[model samples]
Target: MKLDNLYIKDDTRNPTLSFKDRASAVGIAKAKELKKDVIVASSTGNAASSISGFAASAGIKNYIFVPKTAPEAKVTQLLVFGSTVFLVDGTYDEAFELCFKAAERFGWYNRSCAINPYLVEGKKTVAFEILEQLNFKVPDYVVMAVGDGCSISGAYKGFVEFYKLGLVDKIPKMIGVQSEKSNPVTRAFNKNTYEFDYIPPTTIADSISVGIPRNGIKALKAVAESGGFMIDVSDEEIIESIRILASNSGIFGEPAGVTGFAGVRKLKKLGLLKKEDIVVTVVTGSGLKDLKTAQ
Candidate 1:
């Protein structure tokens, strides 16, 4: 709230209670069109649940790989949706590697955003939805948490699509937020470099606890092309922002979901955001996804 003229896009209301639903919806639709019989993806939690649910609806087999540290609720959601869940006894990066290998070997359609371009294409819908909600007005900044970076990159693509269609005059600056514990993208951005160096995650926000983000290249491109920046927020800041968002806006988001709000506060402290500038922060997931951490 201190960031005056700030708006929140409550993507937590999406089916499966996270922004991944949008991406999964699109990916599943495309797979169905291609007559694919199975879809596979790796996620700490949200994307797995989303893909499982969407693939179930489409009458396709779904397989998901998740780090063993992923929350129980998310795993349960996948099981309830009939997904063949693989709990990798390693980091999210390992899970992603295994998922990709399996997808390739089995000829299963990969629904992972980092591996597949169509997932980003689906994720662009969020930007379209936000712009339509705001009556086609482009805000000064659009902020969101990044893990594999598909969401923000897709958002940039949506803005660019609108710009190409002459529906908007300019694209908003994309401000990507990540946890300091798992911030390959932030490290790359801060160092003014593009090389990705893996760092094992040590944060409680499991959804964004990716060490080596597969979409690091595209994510870096989104920030640089849009004249945007990536910032890292501490776990303490993320937890506090979660409570703050729920208290002030009645939006109960998981820690990763409120990570960008923490970034907005940081930007305000640095005097980067003006009171008159409109800022929109995307809340990417529901608190229910990680209720144990929320407590």
Candidate 2:
């Protein structure tokens, strides 16, 4: 609450109530351009819903596969948006695998992040919006949650694009946050190891409980090139962050959504953040998607 020059990129304001909308919007447009009438994707919840929402509005058919354990609210969102939802019996990674094969079998346009490079292109828009929102002033640090790592990678890509175009003086140091239960990227970063070890995810932040991040390599490169790092927080810390974000900033966000803010606190504690440092953290999803967990 007392931090100075801290900014929240409230992506929950998007129509689908998550940052996934941004990537899905671009994916949908690409599908249209390619004349692909059927779109397929997989998610723990938010990505599926976002893609379905956009595809519905565009009059495209969308099929989404999610883990059976996905939040009820997100499942309802997919159903209400008219997407064919597949509740896979296995984990999110399993759902993603199924969606991949199904998309190939059905010849549907795949909107999976990292699997579909265009999704990252779509997400990079967040960086442009952030810079423009701040009148082209680059922040000292940019932070966000990492799951498949597409979102953070996309943001990094956006900064690179802007820098190439001479639109910004410099890119901010990127910080990626992950749950301790799903901390592949963080562990790799801490150990200077790029190889990923897939582990069973056991976090209440289901949206980011990625065992094997599809974009791990790109994400590592992004952080390395940007002179940034990754860190992790416990589920308890993430829950506390959700509470702090809401109480202090009046922005209610899901556990994964508020993970970046949790990273901010971690950085603050480690003396990595200074009072004059301008920081922006992405609030990736609405708390409404997992209201029960918040309680």
Q: Ten residues in a row with the worst lDDT in model 1?
A: 1-10
The parts of candidate 1 lying over 4 Å away from their true place are none
Error of 1 at 286 (Å): 0.1
Task: Give the total clashing residue pairs for model 2.
Answer: 0
Q: List the residue pairs that clash in candidate 2.
A: none
Candidate 1 residue pairs in backbone clash: none
Instruction: Report the CA-based lDDT of candidate 1 relative to the real structure.
Output: 0.90
Q: Candidates' lDDT values, in order? A: 0.90, 0.93
**Residue by residue across 28-54, what tens digits does model 1's lDDT show?**
989989999888999999999999998
Per-residue lDDT tens digits for candidate 2, residues 121-206, read 78999999999999999999999899998999999999999999999989899989999999999888888887888889999999
> What are the clash counts of all predictions, listed in order?
0, 0
Best by lDDT: 2
